[model samples]
Target: METETRDITITDIRKLLDEVTDPEIPVISIHDLGVLRDVRKEGDTFVITITPTYSGCPAMDMITLNIHGKLRAHHIPHFKVETQLAPAWTTDWMTDEGKRKLKEFGITPPMGSKGSEDLINRHPPCPFCNSENTELVSAFGSTACKALFRCRDCSEPFDYFKCH
Candidate 1:
């Protein structure tokens, strides 16, 4: 079975891509996570731009593969997945829905925008118990972009998606 590509619009492509979730954080789609930047049709090719949460993020490879798989599955024959690193990715780009999803998934989302002064001394509340009494267990969590934090009240360990 093939999807009718001739009538497909950029909006249609975006809807399809919304189904693609991040490999590391499955609760949020790439678009909400602020990874999927743009989707536009140029000539006959659809160009999809994505930015990594960080430059050296390991999930980029899997993300690209997933994007390709998604487009191919929808019979989108001509498309380009480009990784744009310039200007860099910031926590501010993440959607509010994405943050809520992250909390529901037991991970603390970045509380402030990247380079914000509050973020310098801020402690992320526990997603499970919403306690401000949290201690940094480790600067690095399961992934480089997250930090391991232990909630004093809940006594639960959670990963905080670091700002920037």
Candidate 2:
């Protein structure tokens, strides 16, 4: 016996996928993080395109699994998740809401767009005290995409989402 496929619109599927949050950062959704690229239907199959924040990002594997779980939970059977590497992902793709969420989550968001000259000299403000008197503790933070920073004012250590 064949099962009937539900006639769900692309918008609906996108909304569902938007519910999937980043495994590392639970406060932000994949869509907000700029990882989720596109959602479209190709014939009878639904295609979900995603781009990693960087090449060989380990989160991609867990993200794919989460996307699969979300779609499956919604009874979306005929779907395919594709990873696109060209036109590499950048912090510029991050949504304003996503950035705000990151700050609220105690992680400083990317200060400027990718390759911005101002970004070269500017330092990420401390999310705790909103102070510019922050020093880089390490080039790498909890994740490869972030850098560790310590705010002198607040005496707190936070992760800055590095621009790429």
Candidate 3:
């Protein structure tokens, strides 16, 4: 009698990748961030593609490591994490759940598309106070992908995830 081996499927790999979270933003999973682009199988090896939110995102290294670790933990022996930079990652790729999670984490989620001078210039509603009266204190926040903002109504300073 011959034993039948189960081939790994994209769905299975996605579930495992979903367990991985962004090192910087622990409140949301990478899956929700739309980082895990595509998964495929080549014989015994599984190839996974991902795109960083920014070209020079510092979290990409940690994110890649976490992805490998997660897959290894699940007994995925042969696999590779490929970085895809072609189309680039945009704020629009972020899942609705991710946006909600960011707001719940007290960080205002980005409202408009990336590189939209007019749109990005518009103040996003405060996550803490839900007030539109906000001011950009700094173009850069703790991370390059965020901007420091203060709500006039609540006088609370918060990070606004930049659209990129």
TM-scores for all candidates?
A: 0.93, 0.92, 0.91
How far is 88's C-alpha from truth in model 3 (Å)?
A: 1.1
Ten residues in sequence with the least summed lDDT for candidate 2: 115-124
The residue pairs that clash in candidate 3, if any, are none
lDDT of each: 0.88, 0.87, 0.84
Clashing pairs in 1: none
* Predicted structure 2: lDDT: 0.87
Index of the highest-lDDT prediction: 1
What would the per-residue lDDT of candidate 3 be over residues 1-164, giving only the tens digit for each residue? 22121556778888888888989889898878888788888777788899988777889999999988987777777889999987888888889999999999998888877764543467889998799999889878998788898999999999998877
Candidate 2 residue lDDT tens string, 33-57:
9999999889878899999996757
lDDT of 3: 0.84
Which tens-of-lDDT digit does each residue in 1-164 have in candidate 1?
66555678999899999999989999999999999999988887899999988777889999999999998988888899998987788989999999999999999998766863333356799999899998888877898788888888989999999987
The best candidate by TM-score is 1
